[model samples]
Target: MRDILVTLLVFGGLPYVLKRPMYGGLMWVWISVMNPHTQGWGFATNFPFAYIIAVTTLVSLVKSREKNSFPLSPISLTLIVFVLWMNLTTPFAMFPNAAWNQYTKVMKIMLMTFVLMMVVHKREDIHKLIWVLVISLGFYGVKGGIFTIRSGGNDRVWGPVGTFIGDNNALALALIMTIPLMYYLMHDLRRRWMRHAMLAAMALSGLAALGSYSRGGLLAIIAMLLFMWSKSRHKMAGAAMLVLLVPLALLFMPDQWGARMDTIGEYQADQSAMGRINAWYMGFNMARDRFLGGGFATYEPLAFALYAPNPAAVHAAHSIYFQVLTEHGFGGLAIYLLLGLLTWRSAAIIVRRARGHAELDWAARLAAMIQASLIGFGVGGAFLSLLYWDVPYYLMAAVIATRAQVSLHLGPERRYARPKPLGRPHLDAAQTGPAKPEV
Candidate 1:
């Protein structure tokens, strides 16, 4: 009974459907409670949801006959190889136990994230993700918003969107991540109400992020806006809405707008910047000297030995780029950059082809939003080790993979010309004729 059910859900269930909200919630709980690496299940780590979804996704593909070509992208391949290389070569010592622990954790879950995108190829699956996340955000937003107002607008009182952090920064970051999804639904949707709801969600998320009072979270929002504007002028509507709405927010803001704005720049001029700068400097020096990176995730101990004058105080580079340079080195860095370029180009191709075509409009919108999200996360990623969440990179991966699928007539609509049959050279399979081509 167990094997039969597993087989059925693995191959049959996921390709056609995203499990409904209750089911998804239940599964997440089960995974959190059952998974071992999630040794800290109730502790606000992303392991529960990100790792669970990733594992189920991989298990779904285990015996399936789906094409592995989807997973063969240059970036994904490089990441796999580089991950192996880093562990084998880099001397990670700050938290050796924690580092190796996270090492296996990231490789396992992140690769699974790649596979999840390959399986979830349908438009509705994306839609389901949007609505589901919207509900989650909305529920938490109201809770935090109410708590903020009640507590005289103190950020400390609000839970980080019901996360383990209990600080609102995590919530702010989560909301920042969800912006692309909201934009995807809003830009691509044909229905009037759905667009309005997405707009509302956008507003709530913006306010929620603002309420967090985290300098990093606010910069992330700004980065998201920059990416959104770069995509197209439609983003101006979102900007306008927020601009108009902020005055009202200021009325009840509790803290002066001037103080709030100043806080963004004055995040304490201590080691936060100094530490990151030191890490970055040593990382590049290491990269320049070795050119192949010290190995994957290998910057801290090496930096301590060479630059810090004390081996005890070294740390991971706050910047992912610097981390790549420090750990994976130039060769790994080159491969990483090339993968990004390829994905961006793939998304561009889809957007260009879908322009002004109604049937393909959603595909184009999705592609643009996914591309935007990747760039947004890339910006946020500079300041933190942010590989735990699966959405940003997975969506980017999906857009690239879907471009290939769409190019081969696998997306929502079958608008492309059907391939000619070899046996009866000109006959259309659905119609017994000499293939009367449509103009």
Candidate 2:
């Protein structure tokens, strides 16, 4: 039955996707983020749904009348450079076959990310994209929240099988990033019932993050909530909710969960923490040895043996910063960091410029929430290997689209200028009387 439903939804939507490619982009995001078909026990579990959707979206995109030009900005430019750098380094990879395989996957995600930027530009289109993202991720959030409650937070919460966020820690970080997007939806929604539902979803999602029992996720949530509070319009109410709800959620977790989190500060005694540090050292050493690093999947025993101070303690490059440094070298790491810095600055510009304008308030609010989400990704990402996750790239697209929308609404000259008086405008000296001619 689940397989049938998923098939019907995908096949039925293809015609519409053909007519309006943006729908295809949204559908692709839904599949990639939610992995709805993966929930089934039948044919849908192994179906090539994403591949089918991607082909359909691209075919329609070429045929559609919508603007096909990519939005060129510092973020996009840096992304293109990073993509090129990855390709340049792939040939030099210590593990060529594995590097190519991972490169293929990352490139597909980057392609769809660019597609999203081109297709979803209108206000309604952007809102539709956000809704798809929220609904896709929020399903797990709501489910995990209930499971945590029923289990008394004893068991860890996990994401869908065979997905990027399949692990408990990954799922927790994804939810931490998602809470801010949920808050954005809650703010943008006009209907009271919908707003209330969003509020409930946020609370449950917070619970779900706690249920994952990820120490990194706990740190990420703390950083995200602080930034969220700072960006919120209603500071007092937000603070009160944090003050009231955080304690309640913490109290609900089991003793084991508390004990695991307590190990975060005592890294010397924690094998996992020591392993991550070892991996970080290995990445740094590899980048120092090979300018292009070891390419993708560089955490193999060979690389570890060559660079690691403690080669026996082999581990994945848990940190995003280290992952790039190892895979693409110091140059690639610089491009990666530059992309994030540019994206954050773009969001900040949108927030600053659109703050007082009622018309662009949605952009302001969304940009602010995206910043909060970045904070989650940045902090949680320090202990996880989510370098090419879909959510962060999607948020970058949202920032670009929102900034474009704000620019279109404000126009060129009027973006920063105060409104002129309605009375007769004061004429220039040349118009009012005599003026000197230019040389």
Candidate 3:
């Protein structure tokens, strides 16, 4: 029954998707991120819904009269280079078959990311994209949160099976990153009940992250919350909420969860932690030996034997930085890092220029929230190998689309203009008796 419902929804949505390619992009995002079809024990589990949607979206995109040009910017350009670099390294991968398989998967993600940027141009488009992302991921977050509460955090929360976030740790990080996007939506909403709903979702999502019992996720949430607090306009209110909520959430976790988190400080005693270190070393050593590195699946026993300090400690590169370095070499790491840096800078630029403009405030706020999400990804990603995850890339696309909108509204002359000053201007000193000091 679940499979039938999912199939009906996907097929039913196709006509609308064809009429409006952006709808296809949003539907594709929902399918990819939520993995709704995977919820059932049936044929829909292995269906190529994403592929069908992608092809349809592409065909519609070509035929549509909308402004479909890709937003070219430093971030997008760097992403293209990164993709090219990935392709360059694939031929030399230590394991060609596995490399090619992973390569195909990553290429598809990037293709859709680019498509999203092309189709999402207006402010309304960006809002719709955010709504899709929040709803899709927030489903897991809200469900996991409830499970965490019901189970009393005794059991870990997990994601959809056979997906990138299938693991408890990965799902936790994804939820942590999602909290800020939920907040972004909450801020934009005018209805009190809707805002309250988003607030509830954010709270539950945070709990869901804690319930996953991922130490990396805990640290990531901390970093994200701190950054979010700093970025928020209502600092005092934000501070009070953090002070009240964080401890209560932490206290609610079981002793076992606390013990697991404590292992972060005692890594030498944890096999998993040690294994990750060994994998990082292996990646670094491989990149040093081969300029192009060993490509995907290079974290195998053979490479570990050659490069890892403890050759017996063969493990996946648990860190995104190491994963890219090991697979695509030093150059690839550079370009990858460049993409992140450019994305961050672009968001900052949007915030700075869009401030004081009521019309562009949403873009400014969205950019700020994206930065907070990036904080979670950057910090948590250091301990997880989700280098090609769709969320971060989609966030990058959001930033690009947002900056483009800001530029369109501000025009070329004011695109890089400083934020307009707030408050009424004071009279000139010469005209106002040398400006009387405030009482």
User: Residue 107 CA error for candidate 1 (Å)?
Assistant: 1.2
Model 1 TM-score is: 0.69
Clashes of each: 5, 0, 0
lDDT of each: 0.58, 0.92, 0.92
- Give me the displacement of residue 135 in model 1, in angstroms: 5.2
| Model 3, total clashes | 0
**What would you estimate as the lDDT of candidate 1?**
0.58
| Local accuracy of candidate 2 as per-residue lDDT tens digits, 232-277 | 7789998999999899999999999999999998999999999999
The digit string of per-residue lDDT tens for model 3 on 26-79 reads 998999999999899989999999999999999999999887998878898999
Q: Clashing residue pairs in candidate 1, if any?
A: 44-164, 86-296, 292-329, 293-329, 295-327
The reply for model 3, stretches above 4 Å from the true place, is 413-439
Per lDDT, what order, best first? 3, 2, 1
**Model 1: per-residue Cα lDDT over 1-439, one tens digit each:** 4334433433353433243222232233223222222223343334234454544545545545655344566556655665566565445334365456656765664555555545545555555545555455555564555555566555542443333324455556666766776777676668999788777767766666677665566677777776777776567785786577766765555665347656546555654556666777777777777755565455556556775533555766765577666666777666657656767777887888777777777778777776766665676667664434444455555665556556655344345788766784654567674566899
Candidate 2 Cα RMSD after full superposition onto the native fold (Å): 4.2
